[model samples]
Target: MTRKLTSQDAEALAVSALVYVANDPVLLPRFLALTGIEAPAIRQAAREPGFLAGVLRFILAHEPTLTAFAEHAGVAPAAVGEALKALPTGDDRYLAST
Candidate 1:
């Protein structure tokens, strides 16, 4: 049976995505620009609400990054999209969840 998703699971996905972004040579810049977060403050920025989700969204936004992360995370690329929908960020527009 598929496990019911929880907030923690979403957070985990976001965190993983963030880590993926950090290590990526290309995606990292996009993350900084999109997030308006400086490289020095990544750890602090990661603590912000929706920040993790944004990381996932960033990955989802790019086909290459998404594919790479999916391969590294051992999840299907579609799972990232599903995770985005499962996670709630209070911002209805970007929440992805219905």
Candidate 2:
């Protein structure tokens, strides 16, 4: 059977993709601009896979309250929200410090 993709699943996939791309120095700048994440912090986080995972988790957990924040940050609300939902479930450590 084909499993359907939930909103959360979409979000996790989006985040994983972003994390993977952002870790690439060539794409990091564009990714940071698109996500509105601070460059230095993102660069530092990119070095650690756990940090990237945690950031994704944090984004997911904060989805409900991110609309205004995302708008203010000049990021697309849908994109940010979707990315948030893409966070991995059952990983408390990743979501703890995001």
Q: What are the per-residue Cα lDDT tens digits for candidate 2 across 13-82? A: 5455455455657555655665567876765655654544445444444454345345544555565544
Alpha-carbon runs more than 4 Å astray in model 1: 90-98
TM-score of each: 0.80, 0.34
Best by TM-score: 1
Q: How much does candidate 2 score in TM-score?
A: 0.34
Clashes of 1: 0
In model 2, which regions exceed 4 Å deviation? 1-3, 34-36, 40-98
- Per-candidate Cα lDDT values, in order, are 0.78, 0.51
RMSD score of candidate 2 (Å): 9.2
Q: In candidate 2, where is summed lDDT lowest over 10 consecutive residues?
A: 85-94
Supply candidate 1's per-residue lDDT for 71.
94
Each prediction's number of clashing residue pairs: 0, 4
Question: What lDDT is reached at residue 85 by model 2?
Answer: 38
